[model samples]
Target: MAKEKIVLAYSGGLDTSVILKWLKETYDAEIIAFTADIGQKDELDGLEEKALATGASKIYIDDLRAEFAKDFINPMFQAGALYEGQYLLGTSIARPLIAKRMVEIARAEGATAIAHGATGKGNDQVRFELTAAALAPELSVIAPWRLEQFREEFPGRAEMIAYAEKHNIPVTASAAKPYSTDRNLLHISFESGMLEDPWFDAAADDNKGMYVLSVAPEDAPDQAEYIELEFAAGDCVAINGTKLSPLEVMETLNEIGGKHGIGRVDMVENRFVGMKSRGVYETPGGTILFTAHRKMESLTMDRDVMHLRDSLITKYASLVYNGFWFAPERLAIQALVSESQKNVSGTVRLKLYKGNVMGAGVKSPVSLYNPDIATMEADPTKAYDQGDATGFIRLNALRLKVGSGVEQNAKK
Candidate 1:
């Protein structure tokens, strides 16, 4: 009988490389390595050669850059889904897309199972599995980190390195930099290793190597530059009146924003696994998107509808952060969010200087801001309701007056 086949989400990284070899040895199964290109530039280079050398039967690398930027990143930007109010949902957003592709490969290759290198303690395991469940529940999931035998065989990085050495696996990782990182088009995230310390400052001299997309704000340019973003139905469709695709728009803004040190955030966020992890992120394009989208919403969205959506922003963010992207609740919330953006068509002009992103001006054909109704200029012909002020004030003050009277009566 042919050996059972399993598709593994491979990144050519230390963990996945080791996992690829281990899966072949332990399960005696044909391991097919799969990598998704979500704008990790050179990271995919030689990935096929590395995977085949490390015991993979075949290697598949799918370029999902446009799909990632459009379907995943753009929709999250539209909903303003910031995980824990700080993170741009960079890693979180990429997982579902990667998993979706993994399932597709598994079906195409006639594989019985799909595997990932996500650890049991991290939220990525949940994200990958949840997406798999949503997409293809029939395919079995083989998570090595959660397996007792795998955990006992390779207790930590040291054991994995020893195994690789014994098996002649070519791995470039060493003990010098042990922190784990995930990168994509939207942002780069750094966590674990030296970053595990809660009180440690990410800006310390030792941690300077952590940043990838942006420089320190102190090292930014001295001059400010202005950029205008045009939006239609909450999606950024143009830049300074130049029409561009979703991917192109993001690429343009990333270059413009990174040079000015626009979007760098360091925070200790609550992980879905019930632990707090300190992560430093650089999200230049996403920062510009958030700022510009808010400016558009301010002019277009109604006051009460905006407040209602704002009230649910935290809940929606929590769901995404916790790896519930495919859940029904998230879909319902997304529908409501999309409905609120029907009239959110406008252009937002912003000034970027030394990490500051400020709204310079905003305009829209469907704007609710009326200068005539708000102007203080006197007009005798206008049907002003000055006489209704007495009743309005009395009605509004009734509760406060009743409370005060109750207090007085109690004192007497």
Candidate 2:
């Protein structure tokens, strides 16, 4: 009998590093570590060496930054997907992409199983498994965090560190940091440590150092910065007239938004697994893009169409957060959402000042706002007739009048 070859989604973090050794020891199998580079800044530095030292036979460090932005982030942005109207779903959206790539690598490597470090309680496990099942159902999936053996052997990060020491696995994490962080081009998120307490204020002096993407709002410069964002059919095409790739757009806005102390969110959200969790997110670029995109839509989108699409925001957002990025229903909704963006082409002017995003102006060649019809001033040849309102009001009030009359008669 031969041991199964497994591909592990490796982060080179404490959790994944421990999982790498555990998978090898438990299964006695060949392990190929895969790390997706979705713009985690310096986190990817020395990852290959760390993974190799952690007992991985082979390592795959793939750069998927542009794909992450254009395929995952931009489409979700186009759909205006935000969990609970506050969370930008930054960490949630990245998982499916990572899983997709992991499966692809598994097939190429001729591996029989794929593994992930996501815990049983978290959404990432669902996202990873769902994606792998959807794409490569034939391959076996391994989730070490759920296993009793892994839990008994390494109950917590402290124990994992000890085990790493015993095994001589080089790791950069310490229990002192306490919190867990996930970073990418769109945003950065912190969870499950001091952040576990919903009452924890990230703005506190001691906790302020936890923020990696932006400064505190109170520490931001006093001056206001204004910029123009140009859009083409719901996608941001340029910033202040400089056209850029999706990744470049995100990078530019992240720099500006971070400087202005923008895109910080703290909230307790309902997890798909039927529990509530507190999370702090820094979505600097995404915040700017969402604000600018909405303003652009206001200029170009029809009122009813905008309202209709707005109605689906909650469901669309939930689907993304609940690990249904590749689900059929999400795809159907995305189709409708994409269809609504046909005329969403325009420029939006915004002012960024101390964590605030202010809309300055919005204009579009296909704007539905008609000054001739909407103007309050009296016009001799106006497109709208004031006399027509008499009949319009009567027709609109008729239903209410009938209902009120029926109620009054019923009382008699």
Candidate 3:
């Protein structure tokens, strides 16, 4: 009989590299290592060679940048999904995309099981497992971190390093970095390790090297940079008059926003697994886009529709953060988000200074902001009647007036 095959999500990092070798040894199976290229840039260098040398029978390094930016990042941003109102869902949003493709590779390679390096205590285990469960329930999931046997052998980074040394597996993860990072087109996140302390000042001089995407806001250029973003159906289509694809848009925005020290957030967030974790993130492009998109909606989207979308932001954000990107409720909320964005096409002018993204102007062919109706100086167009305020105010105040009268009667 052929040896049982298992697909492993390998990142060429310490954890996954060790997991690749361990999975092969423990199960005595043919290990197929898979790496998803979701805008890790130069980090993909020599990953194939490393995986093959580390005991992978076969290695698949798939480039999912376009699909990730266009399908995953775009739709999630359209819904304005932010975890804890601070996290841009950078790491959270990329999990489903990575896992979906991993599932495809597993099916194509006829692998019986899919394994990940996420620990049982973290949220990633939930995200990866949920995706696998939703996408390919037939395939079994092997979580090495969750297994007591595996955990016993390697309780922490020190033991993992020894295992790597003994097995001749090369790794970059060391005792030096107790923290971890995850990156994609949307953003890069830093957490764990030295970042666990909520009071830890990640922005201090000692931790200056931690920021990869942006300079410190204080170190930014003195002058503010201005740019215009053009949107189509709620998606950013152009920046500063240059048309760019979804990938290009994110890349360009990251460059511009990073230079201006935009999108740096440090906070302690509640994990889905009932733990509070501290994280530091750099999402330069995403921050700019979020501001521009909301400002554009202020000009184009209907008040009621925008209000309804605003109401769903928390719910949508929670769903994404909790690893339900493939869940039905998320899809339903996305439908509503998409429906409300049909007319959200416009150009927003913004001034980026230090860490601030302020709106300078906004315009759209279908903009609902009527200068004639809103002008305090003149109303020559007769777009809105001043006399209409009498009935409108009275009708709105009727309930308040009635409530006050009821209170007064009770007092009497």
Which residue ranges in model 3 land beyond 4 Å of their true spot? none
How far residue 401's Cα lies from its native spot in candidate 3, in Å, is 2.5
- For residues 275-394, write the lDDT of model 2, one tens digit per residue: 999999999989999999988888788889889999999999998898888999999999998999999998999999999999999999999887767778886457788999999999
The TM-score of candidate 3 is 0.97
lDDT of 1 by residue, 188-258 (tens): 88888877887778877666666778767677799889899999998999998899988888788888888
TM-score of every model versus the real structure: 0.95, 0.97, 0.97
Q: In terms of TM-score, how similar is model 1 to the real structure?
A: 0.95
Q: Spell out the clash pairs found in candidate 3.
A: 178-193, 179-193
250-332, model 3: which lDDT tens digit per residue?
99999999999999999899999998888899999999999999898899999999899889999998888888989999999
Candidate 1: segments with Cα more than 4 A from true spot: 379-390, 403-412
Q: Which model, 1 or 2, shows the larger TM-score?
A: 2
Error of 1 at 95 (Å): 0.9
| Candidate lDDT values, in order | 0.88, 0.91, 0.91
Report the poorest 10 consecutive residues by lDDT, candidate 2. Answer: 372-381
